[model samples]
Target: MNATVIIPAYDPEENLQRIVDRVWDLGNHVIVVDDGSDISKSDIFHRLSEKAIVIHHEKNEGKGAAIKTALKYIKENLWDCNVIGVMDADGQHLPEDMEKLVMKANNRENAMILGVRSIGEDMPLKSRLGNAITRFVFHSLSGVKVSDTQTGLRAFSYKLIDKLLQVEGTRYEYETNVLFYCAKTEVPIIEVPIKTIYHDKENSCSHFHAIRDSYRIYRDILKFSLSSFSSFILDYVLFCILTVLFPAGGVGILFANILARMISGGYNYFMNCRFVFQTGTKTQTALQYLTLAICILVMNSIFLQIYAGIFQIPVYMAKVLTEISLFVISFFVQKKIIFRHKVSGRGMIKE
Candidate 1:
């Protein structure tokens, strides 16, 4: 299969030549998306164009935008390319490691290949912490454990071209968003070992702003979690209303309990369908609701029976404890299975 290397460059006229030479030497086609680099530096991309294709942007768009442009160009031109790989222009990724990534992509052909970096000596402390947090969220939300979620060195088959084009993030966060979209679509992904090169820190011109951009990444993960939190609030409110209407007698307690959980379950289903899953929330139909209620009833019975037997806790107090436990499990399941959104990022140099 024909392989293509996509490099998103911003004012990297000097570094561009070095990267282009390495990629060209590998016998792969190269596409450089210039995110509004000045024309006076034309000689750089112009020189590389002799060996590869160079597309220039008049205004500086985000890295995500540049990738979209390059992919679109490939599709429109009908290039006979199969695998597409992305790398940074700031010289952070080692050229030699590209072989492993390319080979892995070729082998898998359909799976998205992530080049997991071997974080060795002289790694920045802030970068380390940020990558760790991103990795945790990716695993927790999507059930996919990745060591480096923010690595720029990733390879994908041309079949994913249409999928990547459908993604919305226009900045650095776009990388993470694509991973989420892939997870949502159930596309297979694999991570391969690779080496990273950190130049004596002088050659890095990364625009990633840690604090500001991290907030964006965190905000994305929080969106999927809203359904569970919403269910908890709904449950509590329903319980309060039921208790107000009927005192804590046998009949009052039974009716109140059933109604509270039912209302909360319905609300949770509604929100998850429209907002959280972004797919049809009603996919489960009435049977799904009935099944969910049955599960909740069974859980409630077990918890209430255990509490009544061991501890002399009141029914209301036992119910509260059961809800709390369910909340924890619901959050984990919603993130990991139902509304799982995998996110990966290399941090942001800009807000």
Candidate 2:
């Protein structure tokens, strides 16, 4: 199989040359993206250019942008290559592991192959904890159980290149975005076990910003749910206000529930469209959201009545329980049905 390996480098250490040399020896075309490294580091890329196609960024673009640039280059120039692989310029990814991913891609023409590392006891504390959290969050959001959600060593067929390029995020979050996109689009993923090599500590030469990048990554995947939570809070507060204004009987509770939902549901729809999902035509999304709101409204009213009216629980506490019960259901429905078109595959989604 014809394959091209893309290495996105930003101020990489001297070990980059060795990585590039080994990758070249693996008998695949190589592209090294110099993500605006400093002048002193220019010699590293200059030397690499002799052995591989070196692309330069005038200034530092993030890793995602650099990879996108390389993908664009491949699309425009080396379109004949059937497989595309991405690996970090840092020495973490072994050329053999990358080869394993490539071979896996050759077999599964429509699947993304990841080089998953075992997080052993010897792993750094932060890395182990971070990967565990990210893995859990990724599965929660995407319903895809990936052993390594942050692995840079990945390979996919050429058909997926355009789809990946369209994925949002321009930093470390971009890698996580790819997984979300694949899961939403029903794209298959295959994991290949590989050796875990951490030079010094995991963060020794790594450019990953734990707090900032973690927020970005989680924000991208959880924005919809977070927005829904905000709307839920508004909905609950409105419910409480309406309950206070009206009587404490079922009639009063019914009115308060409907009116409060009308207000908060509208806000939720607006926020989800403008900030969360951020795609699909306004009319179509509104229609779908309207349906979802009605369903949740019914469910919410039933739960509130059971908790507050029949069970005689406090109205405010009942409201919280009702909203919490429907939170996961609402998010999944809206994401899978309402916003499916946003990240739906080009021709991959089955009608």
Candidate 3:
């Protein structure tokens, strides 16, 4: 595959050497990022650096940062490399599995190839539950079906490095964002089954901070879900109030719905800007958001007018039905267009 393998290490155990050796034996250049491992671990990195390129960090950065560090290195020195790959230093990812990803990427240069893991009964409880939950939520929100959302063994055309670098997250969350971004951008994904290995029974080698990192990974979507639900509540309540006061059902539905949507949309926009998307760009955001809200409002009005006005459905029932139908569309627009995350870098990139 003419690939460069990037291994991100943070206080890694002896298995790091074994993995590097295996990768090197496979005839691929290896780059290891010593993500601020302990001083005692320097000897291992030093010895491995003789064969594989080793980059050291002054202090501990998250796994995502380590990967990015390696990616930056690849971008500058190994731009001619055909493929770029990432594997875990924790020893869970096998070199052969990595090769599978690289080969698949070689076949499909336009797609990102993932070495998906099989979550079996033998896997640790936390690992199993974590993968299952993350995989489900990721699919539900992004509409991308991935078997293992957290698999570190992945490969793609060297061209993808820049796109990945532009993504947010310097921790576990970064990988999740990568999946989300690809799904949003319509990037093709090819998954290949890979062998799952756990050196320890408890999977204790993983440095993932269960609570802190989980929150980091799911924060954006979590906040967005909360903001959406709350906005819906406010919208529903306002519609009820307006209906009671003005006594509108058919044609009156348009007036009542628009008034309620405007108010709720304002609140939703405020929350998304300040908290949910955390978008930093000031250009055209107001105009973009206004356009999306208008679209949603129009859709909502039509649904209500048709359901409650023509069919004589109850106003509240029609309102609920209409809002539910528009929910996914509104969320998609806000996420993909109105409040998309700003890329950290500019220009063409991939990995």
Candidate 4:
């Protein structure tokens, strides 16, 4: 199988030439993207250009943009290439591990292969903590358990290139976005255990900004939750107003809950469709969303009754608890079932 390796470099370390030479020894086409490295690094790229295909960005666009640029060049130039591998320019990813990823990709058809690193005591505390938090959040959002969500070593078939290129995020979050998109689209992901190597414990050569990039990585989830929160506020306000305006009884509570949910659910659906999920074919998605809303409405009313009537919790408190519990359920259902797109073939959604 014809394969090409893409290394996205941004102010790389001094050992770049060694990394390129090692990758070249694997007998695959190598493409190195210089993401606007400073003039001091000019000699490095200049020397490496003779050994590998080098693409230069006028300015630092971020790792995702660099990878996209390499993929674009490959699609336009290397028509015979079937597999594309992406790895960091730093020496963290061993050449042997990448070869294993390539082998795994070649064996599997239309799959994205990830070189999963075993997080051990030797790993930096920040790296370990960051990966742990990201893994948990990713699993909660995408329903996919990935050991190493931030690993730079990954391989994918050419068939998935177009979809991956279209994935949102131009920074560190781009990798996380790829996993989310793949999980949502039902793209097969194969994980292979690989070696973990950190250059420096405290101050690594890595360019990842923990705070700024973490926000970017979790941006999608934040947006979705914010939309839900806004709808919740509207729903709660309407429910409170109706409860005050109506008699205190089962019939009154049920009536108020249904009306509140219907209004807020409609608003929530509109926001989710336009911003959160961004699925095509509103007819089917709306139907599914409405069905989900009805289900949640029933559950919400039951919980409200149990909390407010049986447990003697205040009606407002019961409503708050019930909605909070239902919020988690709603997010999963919408992500996995309601807004998931059905691809025709090879799991590629058309633009």
What is each predicted model's overall lDDT from 0 to 1?
0.73, 0.85, 0.83, 0.86
Per-residue lDDT of model 3, residues 1-351, tens digit only = 578999989999887889999999988999999999999998999889977999999998888999999999988888678888899998888899998788777777767777877778778889888898898777656656778888888888887888999989998998888887777666676778888888676889899899999999888678988998999999999988887777554556567778999999989988988888777546598889898889888888888888876888887888888888987888777775676643322212222
Q: Per-residue alpha-carbon lDDT of model 2 for 34-115, expressed as tens digits?
A: 9998899988988998889999999987999999999999999997899999999878889989998898889889887888
The CA lDDT at 206 in model 3 is: 91
For candidate 4, the lDDT comes to 0.86
Better-scoring candidate (TM-score), 1 or 4: 4
Candidate number with the higher lDDT (1 or 3) = 3
Model 4 TM-score is 0.89
Kindly give the stretch of ten consecutive residues in candidate 3 with the minimal lDDT sum. Answer: 342-351
The residue-by-residue lDDT of candidate 4 on 1-351, one tens digit each, is: 888999999888779898889888987889999999998999899899888999999999999999999999999999999888999988888888888888778877677789987788888889899999999898777776778898999988888888989998888999999987777777866788888678778537889898899999987688889999999999999998998787878888889998999999999998998888776547888899989998999899899999989999988899999989998899888987887644223432211
Clashes of each: 8, 0, 8, 0
Q: Which candidate achieves the best lDDT against the true structure?
A: 4
- Model 2 TM-score is 0.86
lDDT of the structure predicted as candidate 1: 0.73
Off by over 4 Å in 3: 229-261, 273-351
Each prediction's TM-score versus the true structure: 0.77, 0.86, 0.75, 0.89
Best by TM-score: 4
Model 2 ranges off by over 4 Å: 248-250, 281-291, 306-313, 341-351
